[model samples]
Target: MPRSTFHRILSPLLLWRLRHINDRVYLILMSVLVGLAAGLAAVLLKTSVHGAQQLLYSWVPEEKRVFALFLYPIIGVALTVLFTRYFLGGTLSRGIGPVIYNIARQNSIVPRSKMYSQLVTSFLTVTFGGSAGLEAPISVTGSALGSNLARILRVSRRERRLLVGCGAAAGVAAIFNSPIAGVLFAVEVVLSELSAPFFIPLLISSATATVVSKGLYEGQPFVLITNSWPVQAIPFYVMLGLGTALLSVYMLRVYFRADDFFERWPGTFRKVVLGGLALGLLVFLFPPLYGEGYNIVQALLAGKPEQLTDSSIFSVYRDENVWILLLVATASMLLKVFATCITVGAGGNGGMFGSSLFTGALGGFVFARLINLSGLYPISEVHFIVLGMAGTLAGVVHAPLTAIFLIAEITGGYALFVPLMLVTSSSYLISRYFEPYSVYTRKLVQKGVIVHADRDRGLFAQLDPLSMVQTDFMPIHPESTLGDLVTVFRHSTRSIFPVVDAEQQLVGLVTVDTIRDALFDDEHYNTIRVADLMAPPPAIIEPGDSLLDTLGSMDQHGAWALPVVNKGKYVGFILKSAILAGYRRQLLKESE
Candidate 1:
């Protein structure tokens, strides 16, 4: 055989050998492969974003760069949406939403195309200053990698989900080189479970991925280190925590509203034009709002606030007064949300993680400076800036462990663990007060798409009325007499008889119980039509109705079976027994 053909023919044989190996060994081996793949992907994406930034950020004259920042976001959005729509077929959604959704709906199987779609779109998005982070895209890609791999190997759904968690952990770990944070994020946010089976694979994956990412970078540059602060500043950190919580609510409110508006904007062409133009205009006025805004965090930690303000529209007022600095930082936090909303709402790819980090940094800067100005105590703004990142991340994601460890691992060491825990806990508690769901789960909760967390709920979500619809129920026309319904019941043991219109659309449901009173009075049975004996179906189900809603309808009517209708046409019946079986099956699967 030719060399290329020989390898191709040998690959599946190797996979077969690996497949029959000890299950534990096979899992560990596959996790290593997934970790390497995810790590490499994470590194390449970072490099690509940097590369694009280097080219775009260098476009303007050194003295006049602010003037050019506006053009890039629009350019990035247009090209991204254009390529996603016309060239890439369609873009995979970024972040934890799609990952969780796929796990629940598709047996943890993601399409093969997601592996690169996120990489390409997110690179373009964050590169051209699309005010979002690459974490979401990385998360999407990593989950896809694991899912597709599992599918290729024909793993069980449970094992497939485990691999997906491994991929997610590896992706996060690879980017920040924080294995512990990566594992926490996988459990707290992506997998939404802290089971023992998941812990081993996730830990191994994150550690291996960290090694790969660390080796590839040689010396990673984004490690966030800061100066030490006094223990008495815990009170100050407490206030900062509260501020982050409030900011979290503000951002989530703004984000979902923008999401709703842009959802109605329609068509890829319009989203690119309007969303891109809006983001561009925002960036033009607020130069620091460009891209992921990690540069701003670095500037704050280094006590170089001038670097951030130097290019903003407020540059003329830069650092002239402490109040001016506070005002600018505060305004930047608010505008960062606006720019991010435009970036994501307008169909751009990215996550809220970057924006939350930037916003927290600003909050911390404002807090530190204001306290210093009071002449009461001089707290280290760097400490506050670093703590602020964790606090805001905790509030936004409602995953305090992930936030705390991520900040601790990246910020040199855990010397500030006390303050970190205090701030993260407070932020998470306060944010969870009014807004119970995190950014990823908010839409899912509203749409009832978040059925995976609860066994009963997940089972309900898995049972499609269409799939459960039993077509054996005998249906009669409205014009048919009760005698016809009698014949239906005699031939069929089912208690529910559906009366349809001339076109075979359900008009009403006649139960055996209701007609029993009239059946014995048979003198008028021939004269009475099926419609006369029928009650409005106690439970009527439609083909794409939410499973929870369908269950609610059934419960409300005290029905064991509901007639399924699609656009007024009778489809079939979904029995309560089928739903029971679905719950049993899902519960068994989970236990196994």
Candidate 2:
């Protein structure tokens, strides 16, 4: 149906609902609906990717599969680029970063195109052997759904943002079948602030989405056969945590550097050709780097590390020595980030969420195998494999709680909860010390985009400093006498006046107190120029300055207002009172 027609049909029902349903009850209903839609979107993307992979590779012979792997990613990335260029207007934002940005800067309003753009592009990228994860794309799709749904319902900005979080949580829950982890992800990563009221909606949305996914899809992503985690492995877990933290930092730095290099490499065609070929060569050398690599994680969890080399040239060396397998695993883990960067930087649509897990599993497997070979102790490779995933996820995303519960819930047990807590916390603290922001937030922070997890900073970011610029203060000429200043002051409501030159550049400020003594003496009214009565302002503000920085300047100078100057010209003054009032209005809006 057309949008106008749809709105017309639902207008009466919406009015009835507003009269009969309270806000809390309406929010619950909206959460369930959004969850269901988000779940279906996730299920559709996963199924399409699986189906495409099967259709493309199911007919190929095992002996010649290596050749197919070399050709598929190039074709996939090319197709993705073509689709994005022709169909999506040559722009597609893939990952959780854009979604977080929308919430922070765009009033939680996601573009309608995002609801389907990510699904189609990510399907082509991942299904055709692109080394990226569908989780981020699906989450973006879900967030778009929630945001647009709130738009249709004509809800307040606060409620719309909540719905956005609901959709994101639902997507995560449906993808992993871990509702608790989904809720935590929304709190830790998406929502700027969390309160008691947010819990019920988040829980309801996540659980509902999980139900929809389970009803349509079967089986978990990875199955863990381990029953218990030994206490003696605590030392190994600690070491593993430290190792994953360092690895997380390495992955973030390498991915960003490679992405930047590709960005500066000039032509799009060159990037596609060179990046696709490079990615294909990497995947061809290490078969485990193909696609999301969840299958490798499953194989590792199943205690069959040999399978990683099944379709590779390293297959011949798989059984020669345990050290050979370790070498291949180490190489694969180190190079996975490059493959992911090429896939994305070359126009593939996907995220690093799965790459981190893939590298972590390999890192954990290598760590455990080396320990056993040392003849010092025997550790469960399975336990460390799982712990490695949690540790790296915690460090990479900077959300330790989400990592802990996600691993625990997906593994179908909290058997490793003790070790998970120890490892994830350690990794998070260490990673945070080295890299303050997560992979999703690092570039956004560097570009001065508002991606804060703190409530005050987030709220203040929503208040634009330029909008509060007060142009009501009368501009006075520097050559004006005290008689002219008295005439302007009588007609002006403000206590301060800006003295400007011929070019409208602010020279100084003249306040009521600055000329209090001059007002009583009219003998020198024509003698004393306005330049003699004015003094330099305490501080100057720019149009692009942040509210927090403006507040800091105001506090430091003990000034109630600061002149807003841009490009050597005076615009107006920004009063501290306006900022406080705007902040209070924002706070009240969010509370509602």
Candidate 3:
């Protein structure tokens, strides 16, 4: 069936049912459904990636697993690029930026295919050592589910955006099994607001998703346990917070530098192949940077600093160097940033969530080890590891609340909550002072985009000038008579007609207001021409004019509508009625 034919048949049924159901009730119900689906997606993605990683790595001998891990990243990332370019049009993005962009510009409507695309692509990327996280990709998949369902259901734009947020919250909760962090993440990153109406729905969605996740997967306390912080550790915690804040700054800079490096690669194939090679070199040398590096994090928390020490390529080459382990631990922070940037910039997939976790673990371990080496106050490396995760996350994501709650929830205790808050708050403030936007939103804020949440500029930015144009206006030749213009008006309901030359160039406009006397005088019928009765328009709208500027022109001329011109040809009339309606709708949504 044709799209027009489909819409013709589907629209009435949608509107009929839409009117019957209370919108609030419908949204609450949809939020639960969206949460279930998003939770399922997260579970599926996690299982798929774990399966693929196991299957691929199982083929390698255990003795050479470290060495062979280097090649896996290259193969996984390059194959992802090939599949994307050849089969998926290379348009599938594995990040939250596009989600934000859509909500801002496209009214929260996403392509239906995005519901699965990120899952497939990100699974391939992370499973084979893309050094990226699945959390962002899963959120994107859930967001698509919510957005496309809204498109199918023909929901209002405002409601659609909220559904998208619910989906994101569900994805995050399901992945981490932390509903509070999930809601906070949705508010800080996706929704960009904390409206009361959006809160209950987002909370319910996240809680539901967490329940689904726990129902399917046995919930394990996230960690290797360690002793609680000592009273003497307070000063050390403050110093570590300052250190993590500085490391966070360095990590952010390193990420963009790596992205810039990969972006400059000339050819698509060269980009993928070369980027993979660089990542492979890092993995070959460091070994622990091979995947998400979670096993290494586990090792660090378990008091086996020897795990990273042995895997350090520096140790492999320069044996018995006491400082080599600490050097490698510090270097992993920078190398992980590079590997992650290469993964995404070279067209692999995944996000900063996993990368930050790995880097923070390294930073924490390094800090404690250095402190002990200095013969100062001793700190538990395990406890510091948790703090490091929150601190780095707070800086990289610019959401201190999310970072704090994530650590607190996952640990199932507030034993580390005080330090977590201290580090995260300091890191977030410092990061904001230096780099205001998170990795996800840097480009968006710089470009002045909207998230359907901006009240002043976003509303106007979203209303496309071309979409508001009424193009059905009839054009009368300038040399034609007033009788000719009258005949044109008889068949058309519009009061305004453009006077065009032989080439259809708009020369003047004739309105019912200006031709009242001519219409009453039938005696001067053929004696008058369109050119005599038509007047030069007080204002004209060009195709590229913004809503604010265009509306300002109309206001200045005291006109309700204006003729649209593109290049030198007449297009149509852009009515203040349409512009005002769009503005009012956006205003109400923003205020809500």
Candidate 4:
């Protein structure tokens, strides 16, 4: 062979071999990078929001301290209006739907356009005075980093999906300094798949991110919880869990409804501008709702429980104003829901996790007050606050394990595990029973994406590929002429046919549509070979491969049907319909 010919073959072969060996390693390294980036982004975004708020406060005269409080929302609304209008294509963005869509369909490539939009919008949402949190941007940034990195390395579609999860896990782990929680959140909330193939990478990425985050922030827990409450709180925890679950479902519904209503507006920018104006006015009246509510949480934890009140238009002071806090917390909870819906529904970019936490805290406070009235051992309201946080999150995300672990990690204690687990589990179970979907899955389902998993493993194990194989499949040979192909396909019952060489080596695939298209061309009247019309080798599946994996591959490719080849020889085929019917059959059998 000539040198050029030899080199061409050799280059691809070497690259392919090297890629096969190095892809996993590259994913691991990128995971670490995502973790670090997410950690830094969270910290910087948080600081910028606070610093801006402080600077705004300073600009006002000391006599205008209370006036400045209302001004906080004005600042947030103005900046958010500018950013959302100019940067986000004038649409309110929400959660990780775009990221998930890209991962599932577009190979996880997030445009820098959307990436920056989320970063700025989320910052303004929380910092400028929106009743949301930074967690949305953190997850988006992490997924974007992984997607961009994976694209650079030319990773496979499956690996790209895994990387999205890894990056998300890393972001969560770093933000909360809870590796296990991060991993579980990735598995349970993000991927929504529990599989051996994904666990290792998710775990490693989360652990790495947590370590990296700790290095930068000195390993402080996110919530700074210190408690030695007795185990008697389990029953109350259950109540808290169930209550939070019901409340989360209600909030999610309202949020989506608000989003729908806003989107129905005649114009995009007008709706957003109007929403911003409304938010400005509301925050102007009730200024403490201006940010992520972290400062509010701190105040509550410091024993100023009296700050909660029934008024709708007062500032959230750092001092414990129980009545004020009650009013603000309840109003804040409702307003946060609406703000999130408007922010995303109006095309402002951001996430819901942060809002969920804030809502949980509010719900917890309410629950605690109710319990206190019942003469329960005066458990600190802060304790109820923590439970409410986890319970609500668990219901919203539908990930009890992740929720419980996150609470423990965020609070820096396993001491509350009894209550945490009880509440989280109950909330998750209740939410799932009512809706049968998490926020992520609901978005995916809306987009017509199917989430396939190995839930019915025993059915798969018992199934024989041959049993599901189509009895009659169209076939063609390399030597077959155009006329021969036409003749065979004309009488064929099947829509598709597998083409093979004389030696029966798997060659290509052709369909009746191809034959018809060819007939419209002058080439069909000549002696063109069957190989000429056939596609390149089809996606072949071996006998030993799991049926679930085969099904996933077919679904991933949207293949109408796939050829099953054994040792390069055509064996059988499986239709998509059969797979679906088989799934139904298995479900019936299990029910029986």
Candidate 5:
């Protein structure tokens, strides 16, 4: 049935049910439904990608797989571009970044098309080896599912936002089969605020999603069968923490630089040809850099680092010297970020979540191997490999708790909790000291969309400055005499009047104080033009300015009101009282 027809049939039933049910109880039921849907979406994406990969490569022999690696990424990216352009309406927003942006700036309302756009595009990108991850795309899809469902049910905006969080939590939970991690991810990464009331629904959603995922998908992403970590390895874990922290910073800088480079290219075809060839070359050189690189992580965890070089040109060199294996692992870890950037920047849909994990696994392997080779320590490579995943995840995303729990849950135990806390905390602190924003939020912070660290600035980001502009203030032409200004001021309740030219461009402001003395002098009122009495405003606000910027200008100029101009034309004045009122109203809305 058409969506409109379906909604028309379901709307009355839902409305009647809501009238008879407690809202909190109703929300729990909705959370369960959202979780099931999000989990199914996650499973669908994984199955489709895995199926496509097997179909593509199961037929190709091992010896000639290198040739497939060189050609598949190019084709995958090209197909993704075509699909996005023609099928997805010429644009597709990929990754958790856009989801967070929607929550912060778009009133938590995700586009309806996002329910399937990222899934299809990411499948095309990653299935044939675009060197990216599926988690972000699926999370975006899940968020969309929640948002659109709430819209269809005619829920309040606050309830819609909560469901969006539920959907995101479900997606992460389903993808990794880690419910606690999913809830934490929703709290720490997706949702702006956390309260006791949020936990029950989040838990319900995450647990439900995990159940759905486990029922259908049968394996964990990584398996660990290690004993408790040795006390003597504390120092080595500390060193690995520092190594992962540095690697996190390096990846962030390089990924953005690569994105910038790709953005400079003129057109989609140019970006695809250039980025595809470069990515294919990198994958050909290091087969471990192919796809999400989870297989490489598996090899590392299983103590088979040699398997990393199995399909590469360096396969022969793998048996010759241990240093060659170490070199390949190190190089692949460093280059994984570039491959990810190229894939996404060249029109493929993916995110840095998996790449960060891939880099961390390799870094841990290389770190442990070096120490063992030096005859310094015989630490458990598996422990470091797992811990490295947590370390980089914490550092790159700045979510230490999520990193700690995700690793613990995915590994089937919390055996490494002590070291998990140590490594994740250290890596997160070090990475934050160098770069204030995470990989997902750096550009957002630069563009002033949201300030992740400050609740006040974040709230300000959500309140649009344009919404508070006081257009009721009368505007007077610059050529108008003081008598004309007096006429506008007498009829208007505002204490300030904008002086505009014939073209409607704002020239200056005429405040009551500026013309106070001349008001009583009838002779001077006729002789003194409005332009002569008017003074330039201390500051001007743009239509796109955030409330934070607007308030900052108000504070800086000590002005009770400021004029808003767009392309030199006067839009209106924004008063301090009006902003405060809007803030109070926003707070009330959020509380409700």
Candidate 6:
């Protein structure tokens, strides 16, 4: 109770408390910064894409507005093919993984070179009437921003990885102008885990990114839907959900198959040229099928059925154009899928998120129109638009929560929450039940990446701690004399060793540092028992317990090594070197 004793006791506790606070504050502030960058990056990318579209359109003669339908795609494909092949060499992956690849492996590679290539390619794809979106690529840019910044700041490895997720979430939030949805996207899709450790940073980044994204585009989702359906039509959401699920699976399959087919082509330029030519030909038929398909969605929501109903073939026709557009949409969806698959498969630069949405919307439109005509409780086409978007996303990405929330936020209405939930969940369940893998995971699996949690562990939570533990271990007897132990320690390179009783019952551990002083004194060395030199109550882990627990215990005890024990017997000892090696291997495997 004396002042000296109180000071001695309180100082260590205070220091410990300060360190904890500092770590938490550091992670929070970093996450916020990540979010802000993501949001700004998303806006910049979106604006750049829009600007590119404007520039391309301006170059065209007004009389050739329809001609753009054919020419723009050809140009986009040519440019993308050139850039992706000669410059990028095809290391960049679509969607979140390329960036996630950096964080999980390659020491946060960020792919700065690939980012620029994608920007140009995505711009052309969106601007010139290729059916795709900028959402995924934008997030990759944000993630690259966060990873590169963290690398520059010399942030810790674990924190840096978390920041990567933050940046991705922020980018997504900024792109869609939805904060909550962004956070969930990062967690549900990017980080693949949800917990207190990740929640604060991810949330801060998402919120900041949302603010930045909103500041750019009037702060609404890119797609705005306005519909007022009779409450009685709610029941039909079931059929809508079912239709959406079916279409989503079909869409993913078709896209993958097309991609696989096209990838067999002889050369990069040929593939690009053929894909471009095919897209161009489709544009001549239905001008709306070109580029990001935003104009088509806009045209659809306005209910100008003339595009699908007109009879004139080349007059920028109406109703006939709609049918053509529908056929084109279906073809374009298949083409876009193949284009995206080919782009990624053949090493061309792009992201699939946009293409998925484009195809999803088209799928939704067709299904909704069919249901509308069937007199099935008078469902609105707009509802299918929303449901189809969520369903398509859910099936491919396997992130139902992100898909549902994204639809609600982007659509600017919570009214679809119930339906979004029903449809997205069903879509994911059906796709995953049949395939047991999302597009990304399937790719990883094909590359020989053995994932344990491909079924229940979620995408990001698939880290295996047991793989870090070395099965072979060195054992020492507790009854051995200090002199004998010194000789044994001298021949061994391990810094710490598990000491067991003569019967091999668990006892304790001793570090080489502990016996260093006694080595010079011959009498003391010969007299001291191994137990006398050992640190009592060694940190231990059960074989069945998670490596996460082992890591936590080691950190808590400040131990360089932990013993693995079951019942009363010592099983093996985890050398600290093994942990580091395991971390590197696990991360590297994910990156490749």
The most accurate candidate by TM-score is: 5
Q: Sort by TM-score, best first: what order?
A: 5, 2, 1, 3, 4, 6
Q: Write the per-residue lDDT of candidate 2 for residues 1-592, one digit (tens) a residue.
A: 8978988998998899989999889999999999999999999988888888888887789889888889899999999999999999999887898888888878999999998999999999999999999889988888999999999887889889999999999999999999999999998888855788888998999999999999999989987765787778788999999999999999888977886787788878998899899999998998899999999999898878999888888888775678879988999999999999999999898988888889988999999999998977899888888889999989988889999999999986587889999989999999899888888887677655777547888889877777899999999999999999999999999999999999999999999987999997879989999999999998888877889989999999999999999987999999999999999999998777
Question: How far out, in Å, is residue 121 in model 2?
Answer: 1.1
Misplaced by over 4 Å in model 1 are: 1-20, 218-229, 316-318, 477-479, 501-508, 513-523, 535-558, 565-571, 588-592
TM-score-wise, the better of 1 and 4 is 1
- TM-scores, all candidates, are 0.91, 0.93, 0.79, 0.71, 0.95, 0.70
311 Cα displacement, candidate 3 (Å): 5.4
Q: Which regions in candidate 5 have their CA more than 4 angstroms from the true location? A: 2-4, 451-456, 472-480, 487-493, 500-507, 552-558, 566-569
Candidate 3: Cα lDDT at 391: 87
**Model 6: residue 498 alpha-carbon error in angstroms:** 30
Model 6 spans > 4 angstroms off: 1-21, 85-91, 107-109, 112-115, 219-231, 262-264, 305-317, 320-336, 342-348, 450-592
Candidate 1 whole-model C-alpha lDDT, 0 to 1: 0.82
Question: Candidates' lDDT values, in order?
Answer: 0.82, 0.90, 0.82, 0.70, 0.88, 0.67
For lDDT, the strongest prediction is 2
Winner of 1 and 3 under TM-score: 1
lDDT of 6 by residue, 1-592 (tens): 7968966886786577556768678678778887877777678777877777788778877676666667677776666666655667844456665554454435555766644655666665566666556777777777777786676555676677788888888878887777888888777666666778878888888888887766666635446555444567555666666766676666567665765676566776666676677766766665544556555555555665344322224445434544555565565555556555543443334566766676677777777776666776556677677677788888887788888888788777576677778778877888777666666556554533333244222222344445556545566788788888878877777777778887778888788787778777787876888888888755678766555556678888887678777787887777566666665666665443
Shift in Å, residue 33, candidate 4: 2.4
RMSD list, candidates in order: 3.0, 2.4, 6.4, 11.8, 2.1, 12.2
Candidate 5 is scored at a TM of: 0.95
Model 1, 1-592: lDDT tens digits are: 6868966886897688766887778888788888999999999998878877888767778667876787888888877877788767775466788788777767788778889988888888899889998887887788899988877666677889999989999998998899999999888887777777778889999998899988877645345554455778878888988988898888888877888888787787777787788888888777778999988888888788876677777787777776777777888888888898898777678899878888888888888888888998888878888888889899988899999899889877488888999999999999999788888887777755763367567767655557778998888888888777777788997888888888988899888888888877678869998878888887678887876677787788888888889899999888877877877887787666
Write the number of the candidate with greater TM-score, choosing between 2 and 4: 2
Roughly what TM-score does model 4 have, to 2 decimal places? 0.71
Off by over 4 Å in 4: 1-24, 62-93, 194-197, 218-227, 306-325, 452-592
**Candidate 5 vs 6: which has more TM-score:** 5
